[model samples]
Target: MASSCTKLCLQCRSLLCSKTVASTWKYATRAHHCAAGTRIPVHFLNGFSVLNEDQKTTQTRLRWKQQMLYYSNLSAIHQTTEVKENKDSEELSKANVVVYQNPLLPVDAVPVTESQMSLDLDAAAELSALEEISDEEAVGISVPFALPPASTSLRDYVDQSETLSKLVQLGVNLWKLEQRPNVGSMLLRLNFNTDVAPRLLFLKEVGVENSRFGYIITHNPFILTESLENLQARVDYLKSKKFSSETVASMVSRAPYLLNFSVKRLDNRLGFYQQQLQLSATNTRDVVARLPRLLCGSLEPVKENLKVCEIELGFKQNEIQHIVLAVPKVLTANKRKLTQIFDFIHNTMKVPHHLIVKFPQVLNAKFLRIRERHLFLEYLGRAQYDPTLPSYISPERLVSLPDETFCVQLALATLDDFYLFQKTL
Candidate 1:
């Protein structure tokens, strides 16, 4: 058996050594490189193993062909993958543009090309010549008349004037005089051309303080141009209302526009407060002194607010007066806010009616502040919702204290907790 096996191996070796098989072996070996990157696996090489030498030789050939086919398929796959990646990259490079077709053109219209540029040159030249002639006829060739010389002299004159200097110092831009050339003449007439010193003395006589007159004039330069008779009448009206000279000066300083108000306008505003609102002379003066602009506003709205507070919201005449005296701003509150506040105080908080009159300033408190303080106190068991149960903390104490003092003394909650509670709400 061993001799037969040896003989069979010799015969197989001889057959494998023939020219055709030898050529195929040499071609396969040369074409298929075995390197670290492309080494054949041991399992793959063993897959062709056989006990018979002839079978082994045939299997080795089949394995080589299988490996070659696998490598060919792998190369084909890699090339296809590269081609797909390049195509994808090209697609990515293209921008996503929204193209709208021209409504006048056909949807499938072919793009114009350079060959379509051929045109009749002589006809184009004649058309251009005709257009030029039409344009020439339509447009007259008159030269622009010389512009009026820039007002160098007026600017130079203003730059030299002491009065103009004073105005410029008070934030008045003289460059604006370009728009109102008459203002230049007005300034010149008031400061230099007219008797300004006597008029200034007259203003002093009218209770305009010497120190404050400059500010008044600076604010309303027209005051200098106003007739002395008209000025005196306005001043006389204020004096007739029992406003002292000091008060008049202070009012003028606070609102220079008051001087510009006519006697009839002034009387109307004063009468509204004194007659319609029935504010006493003292209260009227206090309201005006506190907020001079109050008189400048329309009386009808203020009257309506006062009426709502007194007649509809059940605030007494004297209580309204107290609110005005304490916080004159409260009288200016809108009707809805006035009603809401009254309701919140009288119905919601269960505060006594007379108590509000006693502390009208509580009405002046912001509704949010009043609500926060009251609710916090109720939470702390320091305030009773029932009006009959005397409050542990007075409404005055609740609203009046600053945040830190209120937290430490009244709410007894940490500042963080109080602020956090506010944010949550």
Candidate 2:
């Protein structure tokens, strides 16, 4: 028995040596094509050796198979860990951040820093810090005008000057000046003196109502600094054009900057109305009174408007003149607006041209307002627009009434019904 066991042991040792050498040779053959510095695992080589050993017993083969499986599981776990680490590094490199500060600030207000970009930062904490900083810095700075540093209250800044105070008292809306930095600067730059009072009084002397004087000066603050001589000259020129003193005051109250225009500028606009539109003196005066802003702005726009009316809409030149005289605001209408109103009156409502010529105010009404009232009257089955019918309501009566008045006089609906109709619209 001993002799037999010794022989078996020798055989096993020789088999183990031969198998190890064969497996090592196989590993070297597979690794021949691998890049330099690539590592070959020792346990995988050992696994091959265990599988190829000359073990005759079933128990010995089972132990080798268990050892191989253990090494394969460990290898799989290591590969998974390595892949996870690589993905984590990739995510860290691609992170981005946005800072929500005021757009009005200069670039130098918030400098970019490396620490702000770190992955470990708490985003909520950083965003709150940025918003707080923005509020503290963004209060009084304007893009067009550099304001005095807001060390004092805006009201206090206005109170330091007598001119600003008088302007506020004279009816310049304090709220408007406070909101606009440039307007505040304009007020600060004014050369207010006893002359200021006289200029304001000049508006009153010209027939500008006391209640309206403040509103006019507030709207056109430049009027406060206008020369009394220049203002008088504009007033005298208007009188030369046949505007009564009361008419001049009403014009100034309606548009105070009308007095700010030079005499030549006024003449050019007046000439356009007289010669170009062929409006007579009374028509010219009426047009100016009705639409003073038309004279205040360029006549080129008015000319363009009239050209569109005559050429595009196919109206006779006399018809254009009549429209201008009756509703001078028609000259102020933009091309798109004029097209829409003309289309509605002629094509949609089917109103005749003679009636439109008689009451041109229908052309000046807003398209939506016209549609709303017409549809409401049509809804009540009371839109008796046939000229032959006695119950017919004229386009003038249809659109000219105030909402409450229209509800009572025409629709016979309550004010609440009109309001609800407006909401649906």
Q: TM-score: which candidate is best?
A: 2
lDDT of each: 0.62, 0.69
Across residues 133-213, which tens digit of lDDT does each residue of candidate 2 receive?
A: 465566754555344665323465565677767766766686765565566666676666764678867877888877886
- Per-candidate clash tally: 0, 0
Reference-based TM-score, model 2? 0.59
* TM-scores for every candidate against the unseen true structure: 0.49, 0.59
List candidate 1 stretches off by more than 4 Å.
1-168, 171-225, 384-391
> Which run of 10 residues does model 1 get worst, by summed lDDT?
95-104
Q: Which sections of candidate 2 miss by over 4 Å? A: 1-154, 178-182, 402-425
Flag clash pairs in model 1.
none
Cα miss at 139, model 2 (Å)?
31
lDDT of candidate 1 over 304-356, digit per residue (tens):
88888777878787777777777777757777876777788788778876777
